[model samples]
Target: MVLAVRKSVEWGITAAKLFVRRECRILSTLPEKQEYAEKQIERAPSGRKSITKKSILESRHIYPEFLPDPNPNWRNSLREKLEREDMLKRRGQVEIPEFYVGSVLAVTISDPHAQSKTNKFVGICIERKGCGLRADFTLRNVVDHQGVEVRYDLYDPTIQKIQVLRLEKRLDDKLLYLRDSLPEYSTFPFDMDQEILPEGSEVPVNPIQVVLKPKPWVERWERQELKGIANIEEYLTEKNKIKRELRKTPWEKYDLMKQYRKTIPIEDQKEIWTEVYTQLHQLQSAQKKMSRKRVFTSPKSLLA
Candidate 1:
């Protein structure tokens, strides 16, 4: 029994010594591996320093219509080229200033029925969609307690002028929900003064949350998961909330194919912007010059 015990003790000591040697070997190799990793990181290019400027990338937002239809089946290169040529020609004639969904605008259109031979409508932009020549926007307003909406083609020849009274974006891309909320949210004065943003300043986003009315909304607001609405839960019942949860397709956002189909490729966008940037820049410069002249020439009110 003593000899058996001695043999067991010797085996245990040998196992422990092997474990210690293996651990020491791993520890000794770690510093070399870490130094190699550090050298590789130093050799890699700095992404932040090599990145493109925001101004260069903003062309996609500023000239969205220039991008062709994302649907590959509807794309025709020759037709798109012709449409772009015509769109540029129209832009040369009319100065359509930068505006977004929440922006208040005054649109003057030629109308033979009106006494002045033109009619003006001031409203907040609710939606802007379509691509190329088919691009259009909807404006919403409340006039004399009546909610009114007007859709205008971006390249319409009848449009005499489009003045941006309030140049700001909303939290949501489309403000159609405003129709069910309240008329006050869409109302604007006809003689609203223009608000000018400082040069080189980023466009301001309105973070206002809208309160929705009770049930019977045009859309299923609960299922949409809108970010700009505050009181959506007040209108949702337990059953409605259950239905919303069941209808949710959270995985759709992760579908790479769906996203690719919905957006123009970056290479294609770069090519399109390269073709139109010079003309667009020149037009913007001319608009600035004309605006400056108007400001200086306008009669100033004498202070009392």
Candidate 2:
């Protein structure tokens, strides 16, 4: 009976010790101490502020192709993986600047027919379509009273240079209707000088509205509800305007599911950027170093 009583007393002491240890842990995790710990963490050498909304937007611009097609039927993880690999490989070979529809571009490509074995064209981008390896853009310009539109594949290996002479956005996304408009609207000089924007400044959007030529147009411009064209009404008859009004589906704008299906979710975009950011950052750093070297180095003839 004395031995049994000693065992129970030992059990009680062990339980008390566990309770005191837990209490000490709880005290250590109190609100004040927790805040102090967080402060210390924020002040750590490798700590960084949370990613800003601006940074996310900038990533969206710099890595636009990284966002997979929003079409549910077209999405395939393996295909996207292969495409990104190809895109990165191409990027390593050439520098593709961030440009949008209505931005003037100068593209130099190897041409067997040309005497110099190279040809260069400059025009305003009218459309950008397709994705991955198939991505391409159309540039329209008036050369010697003739309208010339050249479509170039973004990943084409023969492209020597793709320079943006004027970097600006348009009020509308696709400027394909520029074809039906007057030639002057799409005209850009071949030797147009680069309009350099101040570093860290926001890209300007050209708000000028284009005037379209008299019908028949390539498409129903009135139905498209284009914001970039100003004189659309002058070309439309009363019946045409009425038809356009009847065709308008204003309720489609409020269709939440449609927008969700057509756009990449913010979470998905963040995850994608996380995977691509490091590799792209490294590539950009290397390009910067190479460019600096080229700028510093001079030809022997120039030195002489």
Point to the candidate with the largest TM-score: 1
Looking at model 2, the pairs that clash are none
Root-mean-square deviation of every model? 16.4, 16.0
Residue 52 displacement in candidate 1 (angstroms): 6.9
lDDT of 1: 0.76
Q: How many backbone clashes does candidate 2 have?
A: 0
Question: Residue 239's C-alpha lDDT in candidate 2?
Answer: 99
Off by over 4 Å in 2: 1-54, 285-304
**Per-residue lDDT over 1-304 for candidate 1, one digit per residue giving the tens place of the 0 to 100 score:** 9999999999768745754554222211011222435544643675554333223445667777788888899998888889989999999999988887888899999999999999999999999988899999999989999989999999999999998877777877788899888667777889776766666665667778878878688988777777789889887889998999999999985555465577776566666777787888899999988876653222222110
Per-candidate TM-score against the hidden true structure: 0.79, 0.76
- What is candidate 1's CA lDDT for residue 68? 86
The per-residue C-alpha lDDT of model 1 at residue 2 equals 98
TM for candidate 2 is 0.76
Tens-digit lDDT string for candidate 2 (1-304): 9999999999768746754554222211011222445544644554234434325435665556677878779988788878888888898899877788878899999999999999999999988877678888999999998989999999899999988778777878789888788877887778776665655565667777888999988999889888899888888899998899899999985554465566666666666667777778878788656545542322121101
Highest lDDT, which number?
1
